[model samples]
Target: MASDAPADSVPALPDPVSRARLVDAVRFDRDGLVACIAQQHDTGEVLMMAWMNRTALEETLATGRVTYWSRSRAALWRKGETSGQVQRLIDLRLDCDGDTLLALVDQTGVACHTGRRSCFYRAMRGDALVALTEPEADPAELYGR
Candidate 1:
């Protein structure tokens, strides 16, 4: 979820001590990335799931915007950079195991790359996969052909 505020004006993060503690609490996978579940802060809707490395988590904390490490691109990706469907971080939570992350965010637009509200738009019914919703916008239109 995104805010109307400018991206550069995000609030300052906690001090170094607190930041260090927070970072140290997380346990990354072999690839140094944790699975992050993004949910809509206000609606409590699960938007999407992504991977976040230490750098991505730190950047998100500092910027109040969600960032992820793109496995395909092998680099950091700030949400909404291309599709204008930004996610503004509201809160970050760590599971008891410290192996996963939950990010409460204010989503500005559709969360799915396919231009759907969410990536989990399909459901299994009687051993058949059924689409629960149609794309709100065309992917080609949103991301360019």
Candidate 2:
């Protein structure tokens, strides 16, 4: 996996031919977005899930960094732009239906906005919701508002 860096630190953009083939295979939703799940490439641990528009998907494929479409902000969101938890893309996979994406990445830090290693920190232990892990970093510091 490549080194993790800030959103601004994009490596050389990928070859346009390959990138175009990938972007064309995706079946975006009505909102022009696709569900993308980030997972640790080495550990196979699921990290987080986010939405990606064509721009974000193109950027990520070209730069080798995970990028997402922020629905609330209605803008492209480069991972680790505000928080220092960048995810460097090692590989990306499209579902059979091309409606979902799986990003194999090298995670720099916590993946959750709540400062946990993964967004899936909660579980239904029996009939009750439970938190399986503790926050590894402070939420306040993670966002660095």
Candidate 3:
């Protein structure tokens, strides 16, 4: 049986042809959710991981922006709506098994709630991981400003 993946972990992107095949079909398993990885289009840096239901997936493809089902809010959220840190979709990829997705995006600003450029701002040091930087912008400022 497949194990539960670590939070925010992403399996590497597959090759173009193989990825294309999976994306075209886009079949999800019984859970009604698909694992999605947000990746920086130019540098290939992974930004975050989120879940996408069918509606979120379709909206993302149609709108050319990265969208995800916000489990916390229980609603569909287009990235950067509040923070103006939009991620424009460049391409979409799917895993070999077609159960997961990768969104290649042109990210404008922070992709993490903590205001890091990527969600993976922590680095593994000898026995522990440490945060590398402070948030560039304030999260409260994003609410209305």
Candidate 4:
């Protein structure tokens, strides 16, 4: 049955709160991507930073796993998919402007493909860059490459 009132006369319905609303809140850059920093949930150690397109973000949120947009591969890359170092999302937060995201996760195994716990293993010494930490596992062993 059709309503007697015209469409314009009806009061506006409240938008249902949904996960899509959270995704919509993010402000993607020109390339439809945002920077997402992955951090260790309990240790407070930064694991890595990567880009996430809408699809990656949505999938991560829906699955409670960490995913990123691989600019190099031009595809959505699920962390630890091949290396057995998956990051299970504990929480996801956005910066004040909603331009960046922080993914706190429970990381299994090494987070870096280089077999390091983190990508940030380098530091600047007095005169040159240096490796602050050694790889926990061999790269070849981690990726089986």
Candidate 5:
């Protein structure tokens, strides 16, 4: 927790840099990766949740595109590279806790690997959980083996 210093104790910058500053300003795990939540800017729909390391974060900000660290592949992946359903970052924001990221994006086509418009297309009604939409396209067609 930060100390309750004077209201203007620390000035705010539209953007931040420096290792120590980034460490103190943003919260990240020991692995240098932070949990990122992607949402549709216009619809307010949660598209996906993924991890972003410092490199990925910087790359996203620098390129105006969303890049994420692929946990399974152990590599950096540009979203929609194969599917053509790319997420164009409208804004990148941090929560008060600084532990999580909220990405406001303008998404094209489907945003889920399952070929859904959004990754979270399931609804919980009482004890029943139901899928909302059919797959827009086959996963294999978007991402090959």
Candidate 6:
């Protein structure tokens, strides 16, 4: 006898919660933003860290494109909007306390505005900061300077 479930039927994905629900789940900072850390899904490399407001988190979930709140610009920043380094969301994970978020993404190009693969290219060695990796592409070429 065949099973009742259809072969082509995909498992029901959890429905997205409302903005109010999300707000309740996450504990935002005094500025009403949470720290979102982006990591390369396949390589397990940390790409960068950014801040996200309620709207940015909602938009990211709805659009599958990483959106961040730019503290410097005081506005929503869509990844790859200016540069070609887009981040496609693979998964989103909330921390135990729900104060932080981890975004697993497929990075298209360099994740750093400095044209590096990751923003964390500096390491502490012998009480001195050491550069881990060099820029893959020139910032001028990537940003059209």
Each prediction's RMSD over C-alphas, in Å, is 2.6, 3.4, 9.9, 12.1, 9.8, 8.0
What candidate 3 gets wrong by more than 4 Å, as runs, is: 1-24
Candidate 4 lDDT by residue in tens digits, 30-130: 99999999999899999899999999988777667677999999998988777778887777888999999998888888888888999999999999999
Q: Is candidate 1 or candidate 6 better by lDDT?
A: 1
Identify the leading candidate in terms of lDDT: 2
Residues 3-104 of candidate 2: C-alpha lDDT, one tens digit per residue: 354434333335788888989999999999999999999998999999999999998988777889999999999888788688888888899999999988
Q: CA lDDT of each candidate?
A: 0.85, 0.86, 0.73, 0.81, 0.75, 0.81
Worst 10 residues of 6 by lDDT: 1-10
Q: TM-score for model 6?
A: 0.84
Model 6 Cα displacement at 12 (Å)? 8.0
Task: Return the candidate ranking by TM-score, descending.
Answer: 2, 1, 4, 6, 5, 3
Report the error of model 2 at residue 104, Å. Answer: 0.2
lDDT of 6 by residue, 1-145 (tens): 1111121211122346553465569889999999999999999999999999999988777666788999999999988777877787777788999999998887877999989999999999899999989999898987899
Estimate the lDDT of model 5.
0.75
- RMSD (CA, angstroms), candidate 3: 9.9
- Expressed as tens digits, the lDDT of each residue in 14-55 for candidate 1 is 566665688789999999999999999889899999999999
TM-scores of the candidates are 0.89, 0.89, 0.77, 0.87, 0.78, 0.84
Model 3 per-residue lDDT tens digits across residues 1-145: 0111121222232344543454457777676778899999889898999988878877666556677889889899878877778777777877788888888877776888877788888888898888877888777775563
lDDT of 2 at 58: 93
For model 3, which pairs clash? none
Total backbone collisions for each predicted model? 4, 0, 0, 0, 0, 0
Question: What lDDT does candidate 3 reach at residue 27?
Answer: 74
Q: Which candidate would rank higher by lDDT, 4 or 5?
A: 4
Candidate 6 — which residues are off by over 4 angstroms? 1-23
Q: Candidate 1 versus the native: TM-score?
A: 0.89
